[model samples]
Target: MSTVTVVNRLEIRFADLKKAGRGALVTYTMAGDPDHETALAIMKGLPAAGADVIELGMPFSDPMADGPAIQLAAQRSLAAGGSLSRTLDTLRAFRETDHSTPVVLMGYYNPIYARGVDRFAAEAAAAGADGLIIVDLPPEEAPELTEHLNAHGIHLIFLTAPTTDARRLPAVLAQAGGFLYYVSITGITGTASADEAAVKDAVAALRKSTDLPIAVGFGIKTPAQAAAFARIGDAAVVGSAVVQTLADSLDEVRAATEKTVPAVLGFVATLAEGVRAARR
Candidate 1:
C-alpha cells in the first residue's frame, strides 16, 4: 500500500484537488514571454479556462533542460525585458484581483541564484507562489534551496523520470513536495503525441513508490490526451501548447491567446469531468 505523505504547502492544495478526483490542468507561460502586458493578460485568462493551478515561467538566459520552443520563448521574453522581479510583481498583481487559485514559479536556477536564494524564496512566497520547480537543480544540491523555500511554506516540486531508479526515487520523493512532475517523455518541452499508454505505465511505476499526487506532463496537447492522463494520474500539466498558441507577437499573439485560453480551459474541464467519472 502506498502511504500518502503531506510535506509541503502545495500538497495541501494538491491533495484537495485529488480528493475531488479532478486532475489539475497546469499551464506554463514565460512571464513577459513576448511582452509583460500580454503575459499579465494571459495569466488573468488562465483561471477561467479551467486551469486549477498556474506555473509562471521565469525567463532565463540558459534553460538547459528546455527544448528549442521554450528556449526561444525565453529569448523573446528576455529581449522584451522580462526579469525575475517583474515576474513576481506580475503574480502579486494577479493576486490583488483574485487570490483563490494557487500559483507556482517554474524556471531555471541561474536567475534565482543570481537574485540570491533566500531573497527569491521570500519574494516568491510573498507574491502568492505556492510552489517552485527549478529544472536544473538536482536533489543533492537542493538542500539549501529546499530549506529556505520550506521555511516560507513554499513547495519545492521536483522532477523525476523513468530512468530514475528505485534508490534515487525514494530520495526524490522524500524531498519532492507539491506533486511529482513526471516527465512523460524525455527531452525538451513541446514534443507531442497522445502516448497515454506510455504515460500510464510511467505513472503506474511511480505509484509503486510514493503516493504523492503525480502530474503527467511534457507534450500533452489534446483533451483526449488530458482525459487519458487524468484517468491514470491525479492531474496533468500542459505547456508548449499554450505558449506556442501565444508565440506570435502583437495582434497575432493576442488573437491566438484569446482563442487558446478557452480551448485549453475546455480541455481541462473535460479532463476534470473524466476524473469525476472515474470514481463512480
Candidate 2:
C-alpha cells in the first residue's frame, strides 16, 4: 500500500485554491531556456506574476512528446549548459525567495535514472521542489522512482491523455499524487487547441474515479482558453504558448534576457486574472 505523506507546497496550494473558489494558473517554462540566469529570473518572477504552481521543464536532448516550440526551447537550454544538476540549482535558487508556490520538475525519466532514482529524489526534495511530472514514465514502471519520491515527501504527478480509457484510469490514479494532468489533446504538446466540451467531460468523468486535482494542459494558449479550462478543472497549464511568447520576444542575439521575464510574467498575470475570474 502507498503511504500517505506530509502535505507539501502542492497540496497546500491546491487547498488554498479550493478555499478561494478559484482554479490555479500553472505556468511551464524550460529551465535554462535561452540561458540559465535569464530562465532563473523568469522563475523568480512567476509567483509575483500570479502563478499558483510552476512547472519547470528539465532540458532533455530529445523531448519526444513536445512540439517544435518546446523542442527549440530545450535546444536553447542545452546550448546554454542546462543539465539536471543545473536545473536543480535553479530550483534551489527559486526557493530562496518563494517558499509557498509549488514547483514541479517536468521532463522524462532518463535524467533521473542516470543520477540514480534515490539520489535524484533526495536532491530534488532538498532543492525545494514540491513534485515531479515525468511524461514518459507510466504508472506501472513508476514504482522505482515513486517509492523514493514518496519517501521524500515529494508528489509524483501523473499525466492522463484523451486516449486513456476507463480501464487504465484507476491504475494511473492509484500512483498519482499532487494532481492529474489531463492532456487536453491527443497529439504532441502545443500542436493543436484543446476541445472545451471534451475537456469538461473528461474532468467530470475523472472526478468520479479519484478526488485528486485535475490540471488540463496541451493546446491551452490564451487567457480565454485558460479561463475556460480553469472553470472545468482544478488548474490550467500553459506551456507551448509561453515558450512561443519567449521565442517571439527574443533579442537579436537570440536571447530573451532583456525582455523575456517581464513579457512572460505579464502574460502570466493575464492568465491568472482569467483563472481567478473563472466560474464567477
Write out the backbone clash pairs for model 2.
none
Backbone clashes in each candidate structure, one number apiece?
1, 0
- Residues forming the 10-long window of minimal summed lDDT in candidate 1: 1-10
Tens digits of lDDT, candidate 2, 67-172: 9999999999999899999999999999998889999999999999999999999899999999999999999999999999988999999999989999999899
The residue pairs in collision within model 1 are 49-265
Which candidate's lDDT is highest? Answer: 2
Winning model by TM-score: 2
**Worst 10-residue lDDT window, candidate 2:** 1-10
lDDT by candidate, in order shown: 0.76, 0.92
| Prediction 1 global C-alpha lDDT | 0.76
**Model 1 residue 117 distance off true place after TM-score fit, in angstroms:** 0.5
TM-score (C-alpha, index-matched) for candidate 2: 0.97
Each prediction's TM-score against the native? Answer: 0.87, 0.97
